[model samples]
Target: MLLVVNIGNSNIRFGVFEGDECVNSWVMNTKPYKTEDELYSQFKIAFKNYDIDINRIKDIAVGSVVPHLTYPVRKSLQRLHNIKTTLVSKNTPTELTFMSPQMGTDLYANAYYAFKKYEGTKIVVDFGTALTLTCVDKNGEIKGVVIAPGVITSLKSLIGSTAQLSDIEMRTPKQTLGKDTEECMQSGVIFGFLSMVEGLIDRINKELKEETYVIATGGTGHIFAPLTSKIKIYDRLHTIKGLRELYITQKKEGLQ
Candidate 1:
């Protein structure tokens, strides 16, 4: 079985894939200072509950945004289980040409695999630490990207900037016109972010001739997808799925 790990800003998500199917998955908070044993123990307990044998995990591939934990994760996997690890790099097997090849590793994997699965004009809006808009042109080239404050980031910033704005629970608001402070915050965050997402999709669609398939991902995408148009949420596992594809392709090509 292949282990696909996507280390993001907020969490580190892992997926155990047997062929194209993801049999099991888990996620933990992204803590840079956390020890390897702590992370591995957490993963062990999580996977053990699902009846996944940690010893059975042989090959592992990683796509990480948090650079601080790079070596530590690699070491943890190797030390804990003797699993062979591989990092998804720029030279990694992929069909799409990167726009800014060195900007971010996770974004590169997302765009590459998005191009591979869904052809033609597409946009991958990853709702992570930041809401990143990655555009893949009709010819399957990484055209450009737009990075905006993520839903949570924006919400946190709004609360931080304004003393009157109280912390509100993140959920669907009953109505657009909020009746109370909590509802008002929820409306602004959920509905307001929805409008921003739809607006971006609409504008992108207007500029292009081919119909663009917008794939929404990250921890909060599932919540936002229901309230928006032209946005499809494939859960947060898509990132790890993308990494797995690249790893399998590279293996087939005989590239380390």
Candidate 2:
């Protein structure tokens, strides 16, 4: 079995995969001050909770945007088990020739998974901490990318700094023109983000000069995908699935 972990800006999502199937999954809040022992303790507890044998995890593949947690995660996994642990990056198994040097590993994983998981020209829009839109051809090369403020980030930016507004549920309000403050905020966030998605997809298609298969992911993607016809696929596990693929690819390439 393979233990795949993707560390995002807000959450740390981990999955236990039996071959290609993800049998168990869990999410942990990303805390910068965590020690390696504390990190490994959670893994042991999760295995116990899910009835997943700790001995079954033969490989640990990680895709992390949090730099501070990277070493801790790897070290903790190493300390807990003698299995191989890897950091999936463009410089590793996944190829991102066109991506900028500063591009996050999670984006590369999403692109690599989309390239192999689907056929023909594909564009993946990951609605994580940042709304990342990536285009990759059939051969697994990135064509372009667009990064924008994410749903929660935008909300926090609007409310976190301002004193007038409070947090609102991520749901489409009864009407676009809301009658109250909460309703108005919900409408603005849900509908406004939808507009951004549609506009981006349109521009991406125009730039590519061809229609591409669209995939939207992340925990919040479900709220937006149904509202817009632009997203043809919605699989939240895209990154971890790609992580598993990258693990196999790295072994196949004989990377030590």
Candidate 3:
């Protein structure tokens, strides 16, 4: 069994995988001041619900985008779980086209397994603290990716900079055209972000000369997938899934 963790800015996602199948998974906020004891106790309870033992997990794999939480997580695994874990690094084996050191750990994991499993040319759009557009060639190599402000980030900036613009919760807009202030803000942030994604994908297809399969994963992925045509929605836990797949691949090849 392998324990896979993907730590993002806002949340920490964890999964227990037996080979390629995920057995249990859960998520918690990425509080910067969280003590090792707090995290360990929470993880222990999460595991206990599914009758999973931290001791039984053979290999541990982690991918972290939050630098502050990484050390504590590593220490927790080392001290409490007694498992030597491998942090996904730039130098790790991947199919990306760029230099290893330049890629973010989040994009690295998603682009790797997405291209491998889906095949052909593909794009993985992650809607997190930022919107990440990662491209893969027909040969399943990470061609490149673009990162931009997230929907909420844009909203916050607009609200902060303007007096009339009021902050609103993220949700699907009732109609593209809004008649009120709240509705208008929702449209601009939500539908506007969808348009941005579609436009970028269109440009990538035109330049690359290949019809790429667009896979959406993140907290807001499901909300936006229906608003657009021909988009596929996968669980936001894709990065964690990819980490497990890569770990298994390395183990089978005697690379781990």
Candidate 4:
């Protein structure tokens, strides 16, 4: 069994993979101040509840965008299971070549998995705490990336900053013209982002002068993916799957 952990700014996800199949998964809030012991305890409870034996986990792969939580997570797994984790980073050996060394490991995983699974040029749009678009060419080289405020992030900011506005459930608005305040906010937030994404995809296609497969991932991918025909695929677990692939590659190359 392989355990893959993705620590993002908003959430930390754990995926248990048996060979190529992911058997189970879990998510927890990202608390940067959490100690190793606290993380170990959380892991123990989650594993027990899922009936997954800690001893059966052969290897662990971690990709963390949150710097403060990375060491604690790695140390927790080490202390709990006595297994050293393979942390995916920009330096990690993979078939994909990164354009910049500062790109997040999570983005690398997204691009690597997309490059391996799809043909031609691919653009990965991840809608997590931040909205990121990573472009990978057919030659397995990352071209560049675009980062913007995520759906929830933007919504929260708007609600937080405004004195008269309050939080509302995010959903697709029925029409471009909003009838009420909530609907107005929804239209501005959801449809606004939807247009932004579609426009970006179109712009990217124009810039490349070729077809590109756009894969959407992350927390709110499902919401926006179905609304837009531009998104070719939507897989929330894309990053963890990529982490699993990286782990396999590292093991094969004797790096792990």
Q: List the residue pairs that clash in candidate 4.
A: none
Off by over 4 Å in 1: none
Candidate 1 C-alpha error for residue 158, in Å: 2.1
Error of 4 at 26 (Å): 1.7
**Candidate 2 lDDT (Cα, 0 to 1):** 0.84
What is the lDDT ranking, best to worst? 4, 2, 1, 3
| Model 4 C-alpha lDDT per residue in residues 103-131, reported as the tens digit of each score | 99899999999988999999999999999
- Candidate achieving the largest lDDT: 4
Which candidate would rank higher by lDDT, 2 or 3? 2
C-alpha positional error of residue 21 in candidate 2 after TM-score superposition, expressed in Å:
1.0
lDDT of 2 by residue, 59-96 (tens): 88888888888888888888777776877776675554
The 10-residue segment of model 4 with minimum total lDDT is 90-99
The prediction achieving the highest TM-score against the true structure is 4
Question: Given candidate 4, what's the lDDT at residue 52?
Answer: 94
Per-residue accuracy of model 3 over 1-256 as CA lDDT, tens digit each: 8889998887788888876788888888786558878877877777787788767888788888877788888788777678777777545665556644677788877888786778688889998879998887767667789899987677889999997888787877779898988888888888889999999999998888878888888778878888877476656677787777666656665665
The residue pairs that clash in candidate 2, if any, are none
TM-score of each: 0.92, 0.95, 0.89, 0.96
Residue lDDT tens for model 1, 66-107: 888887787887776786688876578666676575657777
* Model 2 stretches astray by more than 4 angstroms: 94-96
TM-score of 4: 0.96
